[model samples]
Target: MIILKYIFKFYIPCILLITAVTVVLCVRKPYKKQTVNRVVFNERYFRKISGTEKEKYLDSIVTSLNDERNDSVSRDLYLKAGEEYYYLNNIRKSFTSSQIALNLSREAKDSSRIAKSLYFIGDCYENSQKDSAYYYYLQAQKIYTLINDYEKLGRMHFNKAYVLFYDGNFVECEIELTKGLNYLKNSDNEKLLYSCNTLMGNCLEKLFMYEQALKYHQYALGNLKEMKKNNLDSDEVNNFNVSSVINICNLYDLKGEYSKSIKELNAVLTKDLKKKWPRLYANVLSNLAYSKMKNKEYKNVEFMFLESLRIVDSLDYRSDAIYKKIYLGEFYLAQKDTLMSLKTLKEAYRSAVEMKNTNEILRTLRLLTKIDNRKKVFYANRYIDMIDSINSIRSKISNKYARIEYETITVEDENKILTKKNFYILIFSFAAFLILLSIFGFVYLKYKNKELKFVKQQQNDSDEIYQLLSEQNEIINKAKEEEKNKIARELHDGVMNKLYGVRMNLGFFNTKLDDKSIEKRKEYILELQNIENEIRTISHDLSRDSFLEGSDFNTLLSNLIANQKGLSRARFKYIIEENFDWEQVQNIYKINVYRIIQEAVLNIHKYSRALNAEVKIQLSEDKILKLSILDDGIGFDINTVKKGIGLSNIKERANSLKGNLDILSGIGKGTEIIVMFDITR
Candidate 1:
């Protein structure tokens, strides 16, 4: 009555608006861009429609939109039509419409629509062909993941898990169900959550985790109970509630709590389960009887089992009948009727083998092997072969699932470019051209200002370095002046005195041509050689290279390390290659190199906390001047390290010389800063 009232309430208003909407739609453009979201003139109103008349109405709109003339509009309409058809239980048309939508979406290269289409198609295939359903679900899942559509992604997971559960891949089913719960827990997907939790419980029960399975089943029951009647059908909720009770009862029985199992089972028996769902009615009867037998409440247990078996057989549920038979076999064996138990079990085993039910077959085989000693070896061999085959099948299925589920998808990055037909517009758009030109000019000027500011700052840093170098040069010039004066004094005091004595001796030898005078002349020549040696030493000092090369460069590096070694606890090592000729480089390049090394050493001393440091300067035969500063200390993450003046100066100097600089560091991994200046550059 309520559903009829709802339909009447909505139908009259829609009937009143039909003519007006049709007139407007006929006059208006049917396939505009925004019309896709709207899908049809009355799409928003039909979103919750459930009546057969509304379904026909939606089908008519889809048929009329066969020549919509817009790819995206057609795709959207088809996808919406697919959804509507699905809710109306039109499986064939739903699959066909969704397939059309997928083709159109792919033609337009629409990723989200393609995923949506696949989801509907998978839903259509879920019952008919489970493997095909899983394949589509996996494809849809990857696309949903790529698009970050979590709700749909979670739905896909539950769908795939449902397939795996039915296929008896319980462990993998449990894994997927857990993931589904995580994704849907905070969402308004109570129904899917209930279903996945139920399956997860079933998986745990199959895995022999009785307590855990009981917890999940309870959680599923809670979800169903807490859900609103409008969100979930009352009858459906009642069905799930009774199903949860049956599961809980079985689990309790398995855990050796038969009293609790019987109590819960009795609670749901008041529902009209026998008439509404005879299958579940049979299951409850079977579970209750089994629990009673286990609890030693043997009265009426056999009658209850026979009644459940009668219902199962009437329904033609082979698996359920076989299970009831096995339960009867166990009951008879407990009552010491060995012949009847063996006969009942053999019947179960024969049917299970015929049906290819591995779980039941194993159950039957185990009991037969335990009691039927004459055929024990045969049952044992069959059980072993079955176990081996199951193992092999499970291994292959797991590998196949991994390959399908974990495969990476590469989405296209291509964009559809609109064809340019307005050739005159580009030529005649003088105002737009001016606007673009103005934007370019503004950007260029702004960039130029930043560049000028950076250059000015660099120049200032270079000036500071130049001033320091100049001060050092002044001190060296002063020392050179002092040395020159000392050399002049040495010439006047030592060399001139020796020369005067030699001249006097020579003059004496000129006056007397005797043998004693000749001996004195030989002594005068020896004194001249000594004065020549003193003059050569002073000239060598005057002619020493002032440019930073060889010993000069070595002196600079030593002084830098010597200066920093006291401020830091770092033990410094400087390695200078033997064939490195610094004179081939110019003063400006050499100055930058010196400043780079100096700043790097200063930074290391301040922040490196290094126990050992190495400064290696080498020049390869190809004229690549390499400077490396290494330290064994706590390093820094380059992405996070704040560049201070010392490091900045090193970078600026290296940049000025057109060098490639690399500062490699990691926390506790030490730091290595390398700069290589290509002399060719």
Candidate 2:
């Protein structure tokens, strides 16, 4: 029994110890195998390689690092691979590598590396997916700013501005360029300084601020010239000089100095430069042609345009090619070759529609309208619709720019205050360390409180803006409803009554006709019946909301008058200025203008007992919409008569639209209402 007890105690303990040791050793064996299989890469050797060799070296490093369990080293290797792929112009691969690196960096909680990876991803998508690129760039900018990497943050802003510029968001691009310039002002990075100025010039040019654009372009040119004189003869420097010269030429063109622009472009058309920079060369040629066309140098204009077209075609520069085609069409139109103009413009229009090029589409539509009166209304309506879309996009871009600018300024102010406090704490630390700590603690608490207040104020501002937009939308909806009600009343009262009168006249004719005269009377009765049918059709069209859905204010006014003709005894005459692009006006402004006119006409129909009324919509040279409604009706005294609901609604809508309204009325005289609103605002 004693031997059995010893066996149980000693043998059981030894067996349990053996099992635990064996289990641990088995786990350690796999770990050792993993260590043996893992490969180490030499980054220095990869850096030493060049060209294809360097790319291959990077690939090797990536392959080796993929199996490594160390996230930091793997992320660094992926970043290197991404850079190599970017240099090779393998954008998809570059994006994939950067995405992997971004994931790793996020897992590691390394904000700086994550920012870098995001920037790389942005670069990869810069040309293909601009909105995505802009988003990534903004993400990187926020992180870089938070980490106090001003240089990278400045670059990020510039990159974002580039995407905005390409997307035709000039106002936002201008804002970003301004921010980048501020960040890089004290920096010694001459390359970035030149890029910022160049982009700023381009944005200003697009915004039609010609003088500012010229100044910036000239400044950039001067910088490049100085650099050239200082023996900076690199390809990048040369490219900058060429680009700056092109910008100056474009500015001159915009400023109406056609001769000077032509001269500048001519000087840029050197054979060597053209060979080295085909795209720039083509653009210069195209601009030279346009300048020549403006200067009325008609002989060589076509030749220059054709040459630019050929160059761009060979280079597969789709946007440039499209621009050249449009220019060619315009040239044909100016030369009075209607056949050729229509042909080229039609082709260009189709291409522009396919490309969704808003500018080109509007230009082509305008030219086509001038050539073909048959399709004038159709093309004009399309052009106006596109203009509204472009304006909306610009408005959104402007709002975004304002928000980004506000946020950037707020953050910068906070950073400056924090930096100042830190400087003070360091300065006081040696003299009184405890006092420094107390001061820092107090400053920190104060900063936190101020930050909270600032955040609250920002939230309040945002809410106010949202409320204002909501109110505008509500006003627009109410105006549309008022318009619909007025149309319904007109259709029911005027058109139906007119049709009933026609039917009664026809019935009387049928009763009065004898058998011998029946054939002649039947002809007259048939004419009366046709008139009734026409009125019914007109009433049906007016009843549908889609008939009044035209974006052009003038077109909508025309439709309104047509519907009113059968309903009202008063003759409505409308005069709209020809040169105005009514599409440039905001939808809310258009709706308000439309409702005001509609209400005034209804009021005249109800009580004016007028014979004639005139409605005029004109756009002034200063970008203001001027509206006038006059009726030769028995007018009431302004001081004695209380305003009705119609008049009150008109006045309220005008006020909400930021317009000035003037009412002139006197007893036994006509009534006239004039409204003026600034469209530019």
Candidate 3:
């Protein structure tokens, strides 16, 4: 055993060293191989390839990437591969790469990358799984909006609109396309603008607005021309131009301008549309043949129709093929071949039914009924069933689309909540805490500034009211001083002289000491009593104009009611709480309260036509001031009688005082304006 241990101890270190070296070489060998082929595997060189080769190379690159990485580079690499795969018509692989990218972007919390990843995933599902594609596009749209990426957001809108168009919801498709254009208005992306315009033109054509459709198609061609100046892909620009031309020609055909349609189609066909876009080329040919057939020029029309059908069938475009068959059936009917027309219409009807295209099926059934009279009842019933099913299908599609949007919005809300929570947690970090502190300080300052502004405005209003009242008080004071001087003169010139004369008469009576003198003294005493009565009358006159030394409202409010009584025949009365001190009220509160009472009294005088009016003011123990202005006049219906400026001013003053006002009135019921305020607050 010792011999075996010694041998292990000596050779184990050598074995361990050699094994570690071997493992290191094995681990790095793939990396070295990657370096040698970096020109091919590298993302930096990805732009060097195209078509099927590029898609295959992207798949290989994705397979070779380290699965453990969750970084921006890896995320971007996966996103690029996914987009390339989608362009190459490999949606399954595209979806896989986009999903990985999405996961990595989420882990990294990268909003822009996440949006781009979701957009690619949406693109992958756009052709087959429209609802899913719409949902993903909506999610991406939300992210783009949050990040303020208008270009991508506009693209998402158009993609979603295309999905709606595919479902035959032309109205909604037009609406979304319009919104997409608004977002792309400021974008320099001419290609996407061209796409949006072309789709918009198609929508208008479907709605049968031929003239407006032509205008949009013209706009689309204009976009294509601008795109060409930008050095956009020649093939892409050609495709867009062809699409616009075809749409314009279709509109012309709808307008019964078949020669115009044929001319446009022939013009676009010269751009080698067949080699570039086979489906659009077939579409152009089909429209050209239809236009020729409609214009009564049947030269090579059947051959062109057959050629278009051959391309569509080879491409397995079932909807296009169905439409072509229906057109051919119409041609046969024009030729008076009723048997062939009925057979063709029947075949088109079956194809449309298999495709679940309700409108086309109804149209084909209608055509079949016209030709095959023996089966008219059958076709009619089938047509009604299809019409009913169409409503159901539209309802189902609407619900499905709405549900998808709802789910996307719900998930976005949840993600926002989670992101906010993460942000809150991040606030605990030192730098974040500092940032938060600065933000708090700024917010606090803003709030304080607003409060200060409000307070300053209130102060200005109070000053204006105070200045006004001061002017009123000056007038009152001047009148009071003049009245006081007049009363002083009356006392001095009238009462004092009479009293002096009475005293002199009394003295003269004292001088006489006989019977005649006694009669004179009685006369003199009677004259003195007359002088006393005159003095008392002058004192009463003085008291009417001036307030008492300690009294305030015995004159101010009473004087208000008294003056209003002169304007209206209404007998005015007022009440003030015994404990309330007018001097202790804040100016803002005091002036508003004064103005409110003034306004209410004026309103009653002018409008109420009441025989009696009362102003009651009370202050509770907790400093709550309650005021009521009541009138017993022919009352108005509050709802019927709109509040005039007087009532509005009263309410505004009450609000300025931070008080609640309730005006209760009904026909034949006296109006009562009740106001309450917490003065201490």
- TM-score versus the correct structure, for each prediction: 0.50, 0.54, 0.54
CA displacement after TM-score superposition, residue 534 of candidate 2 (Å): 52
The sequence of per-residue lDDT tens digits that candidate 2 reaches over residues 1-681 is 685556555654554465456546754634333333355556677667777887676677777776766456677778878987998887887998899899889977889889999999989989998767877888899899889888888899899999989888787789888898889877767777788889898899888788998888876776676676667766668788778877888778766688898887788788877888888888888888898998889988899889988998898877778778888988998998988888888988998888888788888898898897788889878887888988887777655644655776688789998997865554444325334324444444458768998999999999999999999999999988977876654544444434544454455556655774477456546756755665666556644333335455577678666545534578999888877776566676766777677778778877788899999887764577889999999988877889877788778777776788889988779899999998866
Tell me the deviation in Å of residue 367 in model 1: 2.0
Which residue runs of candidate 2 sit more than 4 Å off their true CA positions?
1-58, 68-76, 106-111, 127-131, 226-233, 391-681
- Residue-by-residue lDDT tens digits, candidate 3, 470-494: 9999999999998886676455434
Candidate 1 lDDT trough over 10 residues, lowest sum: 410-419
Clashing pairs in 3: none
> If both were scored by lDDT, which would come out higher, candidate 1 or candidate 2?
1
lDDT score of residue 263 within candidate 1: 92
Overall lDDT per candidate, in order of appearance: 0.78, 0.77, 0.78
